[model samples]
Target: MVFAASPLHADTSSTAGGAIEIKNLAKRYGSVRAVDDVSLVVRPGEFLALLGPSGSGKTSILMSIAGFELPDSGSISIDGRDVTYLPANQRNLGMVFQKYTLFPHLSVRDNVAFGLKMRGVAKAERLRLAEQALATVRLEGYGDRMPAQLSGGQQQRVALARAIVYRPKVLLMDEPLSALDKNLREEMQLEIKRLQSQLGITVVFVTHDQGEALTMADRVAILSQGRIQQLDEPKALYERPRTRFVAGFIGETNFMPVEVQSLLPGGALVQLPGGANPTEVRAEGLVGNIVARGDAVGALRPEQITLADPDDPAALRAVVNGVIYGGSTVLCVAQLTDGTELRARLPDPSRVNVMAGDCVGLRWPVEALRVYGADAGAEVAAS
Candidate 1:
């Protein structure tokens, strides 16, 4: 369903409270340091996503911002107001969780108006505001229905309407679409983005799914081991990751051992295990430090490598181990002489004819390879 932009109210100047600044926020749970010395800034009307795996401190930071969890050290401020020690209710922030968290017994309209009622808004005004919120969520005619009577997507929309009916300064979402099916989750991603744009609302979203974060967020903060590993736009995070962890976590990559030969202007020349000669990598492709005569790992994406004839002089020789068909794309798994398995993604499986055990050559552009230090490789393996 397509939804046209509509104002929640005639005057929404008060809903422009969107800037959030987090300074040295630290939270610990007994022996586990959930969040450690993390600082971030969310711009007004910007959608920022906190993305990380389990135990990566993404949720801890979101909860701390929502005033659900207090930090051991650091302060949180919204639009220049320090709210580090403020109560959750006093923060005036809208929150939506993975679960719908709807009142089953109450009508949808009442559920959306509950927050307004608690704030002592007059009955008529609160009901009118609730109806407007329901309309904003594309559920204008369903306000009289009960929560249990709605589908999962409908229930989630109701929860969202309730959160925004009060017109909070910042909206905090804790994997709100995690429980939905893949198609529904993707649909909601666009819906939420549209709503946030129409209302000019600042949103802080938490999720472990990389695709979801890339699809919905203007910028993403990737956390690992209670620290912000990298914060960049989706394209930058995928194309020019700052660390080995960020590269591996953001998308699929093949890591192969390489020997650093010499240092160049912006990057270094590295020799692959079974490569024909040393190849130059740009500075942006280099993840960690690379000293001369040192060991490092070269990261290459599957799509970057192309299949070539084994007789090609510059191509790396390998034997095809397997061929897996995946609808539009085909995966060719090949092993080099040094037993390093690399995968190459090819488009149109029908056009490619190669069997397992066949000899093939792997070739890629010079800038396609990313060099990471030996220590960084070990850290990625440990994670």
Candidate 2:
């Protein structure tokens, strides 16, 4: 007699939808290592987005998880079951890809029913499940429409309904929204987020768009060169970036080179090497804090600085170089006395009405400075 319910069986999604654990996963294509020893954990019911630039191993890692591409060496376990060798069809995963792959000949209801029918579900139950799935995607009355009869968004929803109709253990999406127009994409993002939260399923999505990752993910995994550079909440990753790549990639910043003169308990006093008059400024928690005698660079966000009159005691005197008006806010590019280029963001363009060669001053809070050591050009590892 065979016992069916074993707590420690070779199963995937063993822990209430299971926790995905990847250990030292590696994938190679002849000489190029597409995915290089990536390890990460996707917790239960969490939405994780693999974010990176093109060719950054985000898709490769997704493929590895789906068993489309076997790793050279590594262990993949969902819950506690070893799924390293399991085929893609056996993994019980719902997937949506860039293209809406719904069959043109099949009606929406038939398409959603296909998965269940293949699993040997009874006709009456499969039709009921298909109707329920269409309702889940908010297409209750249009179940009989064929793929070509619906709009792009509607077709994608049909594909989604098909994927989730069978209630898979996990959901994996690879750039599912890239093909849609901007407004539609945004709308679908909110819809998808709501659906995922409602189902309480583990979702691993891949996208190169920074804003999408920041908005949709519970935690984001920043990937480059087939490895994870940083994995954290979007706010934490933005506020306290550990690497120079994280500082530069996540948002817009102005990098200014500075040489450390002395380190203080609360902050540091540094001299801007290229600034006019070699002005010394006090900054807190910057790149050179850990280093002693060397040149470093400080990152300043555009919104962090303020423009004011040169004669003001509170402002650092500089000349307005250029201005770019952007409705709600204006981007003012100014040159310091030492010819250091700086940008300041203001709510209104009228506040700093000045032409080129006009002298001004710039001021910023002490906490906005970010210090990076000399070799801040290191690339981020993507997965």
Candidate 3:
């Protein structure tokens, strides 16, 4: 679970890595723009994740950076030097793909030394470095085993060892944990974070999984339709998503339609779709031009909502549709009179066990709601 950082193999000291600058990067197919005019800067020693669903162009941008896909336009640079058209083999970078691409005939040590071998490293030195790299990945004894003789996780560790043995300036990983099971994926997430921190290598990780991005990256860029909708640290992106797309994609939330009565100095006052009470929500992050008086959506996470006390008169009425018992929490699905579905996650499932068709009250703090411009997918029950 810890990297074996021997002085000669991996740089375990706290060091800043090379910065990467991408400018107006664009790539296109016959009729579709794979990477629209996009630009970003990855800070030295930062774990930057390019996150989005399929067709979001995250992979395209990554491939272009790796020199696997030639961009139609734009330039990429590392530490102020241009490598826009550099050959992939000459980039001096480490790469880990989703699939385990280890050579079946090569032992773990040989596979780890393959990159060095290509660079014409003497056989004995490469083998020594390979042994050190395996130790760095906590696979010290597995170096003599063939790739086909290792488990998926062990093979991944070998791949990681191979990538780091030559000391590349930057590390690029494309969904490297996608093939692992849930437990392994989580374990690798922590492992990767530790290794990256230890090596001080600039990492650009491409992943469609939001949890993975939030868990591993120092900064996350959420791309959609070949454009970045939001770029911020994990907590900031989750708590104050600037756009509806980001709010919905990063986590599950109930979005209620509301009519903006007025924009206040600190926030906005809006009336819920079917409620008479006008609630105030902090709208400091909304663009000035976009916070006009009209329709908007209120974003609230399910865990923020709770069952109301029997005596609370202002509680909203909801009919329980179903209750699902998770190990540590419970999810209650309910429906309002106007057909709006709401979900409340309770810490204890048996707190107030109301079976299907039972009417109950729901309560949530007004301050917990976040307001956004209403769009087509602004349904309250959307996850």
Candidate 4:
């Protein structure tokens, strides 16, 4: 049975499940700065992901928003109200963690209704709300089952139901799906997104997984060394990364050293090696300010590269080192005469038929190349 829509969901005001603003947030542990002057705003009812490796300060920022970690400096405001010093329980936010954290002794319904009980909700009303929450998570009939009796996925659903049972203004998830297996994790990713859309609740998710961040978030904030490297939509981040770290981290890319012959209006003309005549290509999507005669790195996605005949005039000569057969595509690893390795992703091994130790030519579209200064720093921005 589906639960009727609550009146809370009908409130479309910006203050209802509203925007989250963090301004110049800073945190430190001894001499190490966990969060370094980080600032960003999460739009109302929008799903935002904090993505970065360990020591990148993603978790510190999230903890501060949840009121678990007090910032050494900076402020956090929710819907324009200063909540930086508010207690975690008083913030009226919901949270889910990596572990399900279900009580083994309690039945699923009671587990989900526990928070309501603590808030002085009466018995019958809380139970009714708990069952409705279960139905929302597709676990209506599992309410009587003990936590230990349910599978990992079902237990996680119960945890989700519990978190949303009180209809919080904002939901914070910290790698909540990390404990589940790959298939189950993917299924829950869609489940969480569906629930969030249905309830019109804002979400702030923290994960180190790039694909998860890309697939689930409306906008992703990528952190590096306690700073936001970039905050953009998945398509923008993938197509035009502002930093070398972002380009390498977001997806598979091939980086080659090149000499910048000259700078164009929005791009650069670079000279590539390994051809009879030096192949000078006009590379667009320049990452940073580049100058003539300077050394830079050119980046191309594996799928952007094509294999050609060795004698092709416009191709760079390379020798195939190995081939990896993926389900729908094959990856060819090749090396230029200068020993720079490049990977080309081609469709269908049967169609291409290139073998290991074979001499080949690599070519890509001029617009597909993104050139970056060898030591370029990230251009930080928020949306």
Candidate 5:
């Protein structure tokens, strides 16, 4: 049987939903491994986003979960019930695609009621459910309008209403806002998040947009080359990425080459190789208090770095080469003593007077430093 009771006759509003576990999943297309040995546990009622760049296998994994694409190996279970081999129609999932796939010929109300209609729900009861779903999406008055009559955001809202009108246990969205403008996309993101929290259904959203994932997902899985580089809460993922790919992908950062001097109980001390193009920096503060000399590189975020007074002894001397002023903040590019390029984010661009050819000291807290494996990169600088 399907994991959750059918929303048609069940009081799905109070349903807590079911957990999904994907184990040792693999998918291949000829010589290319599209998804390789992926495993993840999505908690009940959790919002998880599969985040990655194009061709990173995030969409492939989502398709596998939705039963649109069959995995070559491993298993998929919802609430301990195996559905790895189940057909798409039997999985009882709600889905919204990047494009609004609503029936062009159907009115908004008809589109929202279509799933319930297919389930043999009584016509009157299904229509009521459809109205409720439309209200949930704040499209109560637009139910009579055809898909083409509504704006893009309104169409997406209709799609969302249709997806949930049947009270689906899990909702899968594949870059549903990719086509919307930035402002509208962000607005829809908040709308989607609010509905997801209120509905308490398990949601798996796929997106290449890091901001979208960070803004909506309870946890994010960063995918690359058919594997997950890291999976963690948005704040944790941003603060402590476990891999270089994750650190680089999540936000702005600078990776510098350094030699590991010693690993401490909670951090590492390293020496920066002062070379024009010397690579690597060592960092710590991950899961372990201790670390061995691996393919680790020093990671420091742009915002965490600050310009220091020349008299400060704990600062790295750098010569300001370029400064680009954003609306509220400035991006300062500098050349270190070793000729390595460094970037610092200075807030209050209007107040800060940093300019090119200015010599400044850059410093950051030791705790803010992180060391991620360079295995994500093709070359490991010989330290």
Candidate 6:
């Protein structure tokens, strides 16, 4: 169902409060440091996404915040109250788990009212709250339907409505959309995002899907091997990654070897792949010693590199080796004269000229280039 934007009277104070402070939080599973010395402040009502692959400690951190996995060290506080030692139920946080945990025999309305009933809310008041929560999820008329009678998307909404019926301080989502079909997943992403804004709820979302995080988060924290590699607004993290991991994890990139010849105010001038003239580009906070005088890899985003006519003014040139067609765009893999591989993203299919085995020049705007140490390759897969 389509929902035209409408204002709701959710308590805006839920998000304007202090913050969720996690200071030096660490969790251990036998010999493993599942979550290591992680510390971050989640702003009130802000949507913060913890993004990483499996075993990256993203879930561990989420559990810690929810009072599930107690940290061996560090402290967790909401607003100003110390809930580090509190039990999960006492935390007053709403959670929509990855798996639907609705009762098989109960109707959607009863399932939503369950939380209120447990909290001792009056029966009439609980029903009214349940109906309002259903309305928020656009399931107003389906409250009487049992879980078995609802579609996957509808069931997920029921789970969501159940979590929010009591108006908790924060919403914890653990891959909540992973079970839905692609179209439904995308739809719910928008739905939840709108609901978060309307409710002014501080949402802590956990997911490994980069596209989901990019589409939904106000801020994203990239975690790897129990550590936070980077955290920032999605655009900033994508465009100006602080480490090799950040450069590679957020999207596709082509790393080509280069020699750092000079360092500029906001960037460095580096020798091109084939001893070509130095190209100036930003390296922002990259290790200076790694490129002080030797060879390094230039991190170029796939979309940043462009294929042009042989005589085009753009700098590098290469021979097209293959093309991977995606409906809206194409992935073109090319080989430079130095035997280095380059990938370019063509926005419009019609603009791409070089086909398999065709020679063409490749040019990238200097500002789009990023330089990293030779060891950047090791972290490429992580980013």
Better of 1 and 2 by TM-score: 1
Q: What lDDT would candidate 6 get against the real structure?
A: 0.81
How does model 1 fare in lDDT? 0.86
How much is the lDDT of residue 122 in candidate 1?
79
Stretches of model 6 off by over 4 angstroms after superposition: 1-18, 283-290, 311-314, 374-383
- Model with the higher lDDT, candidate 5 or 6: 6
lDDT of 2: 0.76
Best by TM-score: 1
> lDDT tens digits, residues 291-325, model 5?
45443467789999889874566677788999998
lDDT string for model 3 (1-383, tens) is 01111222443234457789999898998889878888899998999999998988899998887878889999998888787888776565678999879999988888898877666667898888889878878998888899889988888999888888876668889999999999989999999999999889899999999999999999999888787787899999898877777788988888767678888888777776555367666656342243456776677788888887534555667889998888778888888767888888889665757778888777787667777764423222111
Model 5 TM-score is 0.90
Q: Which stretches of candidate 1 lie over 4 Å from their true place?
A: 1-14, 374-383
Q: Highest lDDT among the candidates is held by which one?
A: 1
Between prediction 2 and prediction 3, which has the larger lDDT?
A: 3
TM-score per candidate: 0.94, 0.88, 0.91, 0.93, 0.90, 0.91
lDDT of 2 by residue, 1-383 (tens): 00112221222222234479999988898988888888899998899999988877899988888878888989898777787878777676778888877878889898888867666677888788789878888899988888889998998888888777766657889999999999999989998898888777788999999889988999998887777888999997776665677777787777777777666666566665333333334443464234655688777788888876688765667788888888888888888667778888877676757667788777777677777775544465533
RMSD from true fold, candidate 5: 4.2
Residues 200-296, candidate 6: write the lDDT tens digits: 8888999989999999999999998788888899999888887777788889988778888877777777877753467776656354355556888
Collision pairs in model 1: none
Worst 10 residues of 1 by lDDT: 1-10
Q: What is the C-alpha lDDT of each candidate?
A: 0.86, 0.76, 0.79, 0.84, 0.80, 0.81
Any runs in candidate 3 off by more than 4 Å, and if so which?
Answer: 1-16, 285-293, 310-314, 374-383
Instruction: State which candidate, 1 or 5, has the greater TM-score.
Output: 1
Task: Kindly give the stretch of ten consecutive residues in candidate 4 with the minimal lDDT sum.
Answer: 1-10
TM-score, predicted candidate 3 vs. hidden true structure = 0.91
Distance from true location, Cα of 96 in model 6, Å:
0.7
